[model samples]
Target: MKFLEENLLDHLQRPEFAELHSVLINHKFSKGSYICQPGMGSNQVFIVVSGRVRVYLGCEEKEFNLGILTKGDIYSTHTGTFVQALTDAVVLMTDVKTFRQRMVGDPEVTKAMVRVLGNILKTSFTIIDGLAFKDVNSRLVALLSNEARRHGMSLEDGSVQIQIDLSVEQIARLVGSTRQTVSMLLSDLVRAGLIERPERGKFLIPNLSALESVGGVTLS
Candidate 1:
């Protein structure tokens, strides 16, 4: 049998997922709305059908972004992370118990769930590693480099433009620094000819290799 697809959107077209699909409840969230907050007793699994959601952890004083889920990504709400819409969004969701039951009956689906959980674990470890080993500037550079690889559009002039869709404050949260610090670092980058801001919520890397060099980490 074919292994289940990673994208939940693809699963919607598969006969094997029909039962689970039938039970999915559709919900919409406006930008900055919380889909799941800590200690909310959330027990649902959700798939992002449209727009972007931010998974993060923190108290009122500080926050750390765990990951951003765009269309086709899946997550379980019971993971205790705060899930908030970064943009106006729609999601299809079902109770965790129902999803577990389906996984128990379907080996392929179980495999897919395992892969999803594995990715989540890997991301956690990466964050931990960055916190323990990297300084603030290094962490920010790594974040930008990774985002470029994942979401950038190449230009004819050998530059890569990333629609990062995050304010400097949000980026500071992701890199565990103050917004003023991040802003200064960004200015330094611009002066060093590493990056440019052509518009709000976007970044242009004139030389991705040079930017990656400053972080001293290999891009996989």
Candidate 2:
């Protein structure tokens, strides 16, 4: 199974999950589709099998993105938040009751839950820190630095390239800024030799230290 290959369902793969296999609802959402919204029932848990989901807060006029989750990531909320598909996505959905029942017999499943919870805690703190303390430029730099650490391709010249195809509007939403503000800051970053758009859809950090200074950050 693809879940086995990706280790997505690793913890839940005990014999217990066999029963769930028959009942799990598999659905696809086009990009910009809402997986769930505020006031929606919170009884279901969703696990992404493909593509990406954005978890955010606020109304249609303005949004503060919490984070983005891709393949193998999971989400559920007791008080539901706004979750929308960032790309056309395949997801598995099941009632929280069914999911909890499956966890009863598996120690590994509990451990997986702990791991996921820890990550959620950490990410929550990071988001809070970004929103409370960091300026828009700093937040953008932090976002870019995070991408570089996660997906950068190191070039021979000690620079790093990140193939982030996000639009300025998307990036603005992520950093809790307007597109115009992000665009101006990006231009400043470019002028300072901090970041470059090497191609149409990629960003190159020619000097990591310079980029960090501009963002007032130091990524460890």
Candidate 3:
């Protein structure tokens, strides 16, 4: 998903960023693999080159998804969150020390890192608000609305189509709800004409604004 922050890789062509790029080591992770876990003491910065990863918290009994990182997304291992690959993925990573040293000589890199951290902070706040104030339905709607804004395509009839290949269980995890609740909400949305599941893992929104209104939450 696109964030307000500029991607660090955007400066790859510049001489100042060459050192950073050169130090990145490509790593492949299988689907369902844990790239990092809580208390791992990892000191690496990772840039997702392909596939998807879920950043989450909590133990095996219960967990809350913080966010999903797809291609071009950046994350650091210093966070205590667990990062698991949702699909076979490739990531380019470098030690935190190397990254910090490079940033000292690169203003653009520093700016990008700052923006990345800002986005993470905003996401954390949003999750907290949803858990503390919003109901399950509102949280689900907000999740779908954010996904639509981030990954949706505009159609000729003013509708927005989002191809999010996420399962009901995964959706539930993201919104901190049960799978049954998410399934019921999806069905309700379909019946209400706010959304249509034309195919698996795809949603067509007949009225984008109407759908957003259903959420009753201001998306970032």
Predictions: Cα RMSD each: 3.4, 4.1, 2.1
lDDT of 2 at 175: 83
Stretches of candidate 2 off by over 4 Å are: 1-6, 10-16, 77-79, 151-166, 198-202, 206-210, 218-220
Lowest-sum lDDT 10-residue window in model 2? 1-10
Q: Which tens-of-lDDT digit does each residue in 1-220 have in candidate 2?
A: 0111134555345565777544568989998898899887667877777886777676566665555666776677553468888679998888889888755765655565465556556656786898899899899998888767654789999999986556888788878899999999998888888899877558999987778877888654
lDDT of 3 at 56: 73
Tens digits of per-residue lDDT, candidate 3, 1-220, equal 4443344556665776787788889999998898899889889998888887877777555566666777777888888888898789999999999878766767766666667677667778888898899999998888778767876788999998876667888778777888998999999999999999999778999897898788896855
lDDT, candidate 1, equals 0.81
Stretches of candidate 1 off by over 4 Å are 1-6, 103-105
TM-score of 1: 0.89
Writing each residue's lDDT as its tens digit, candidate 1 over 1-220 gives 0112456678566887787788888999998899999899979988889888888788666677666787777788888888898889999888998877765566655566677677667667777888899999899998888778765789999999887677999889888889999999999999999999989888999999999999875664
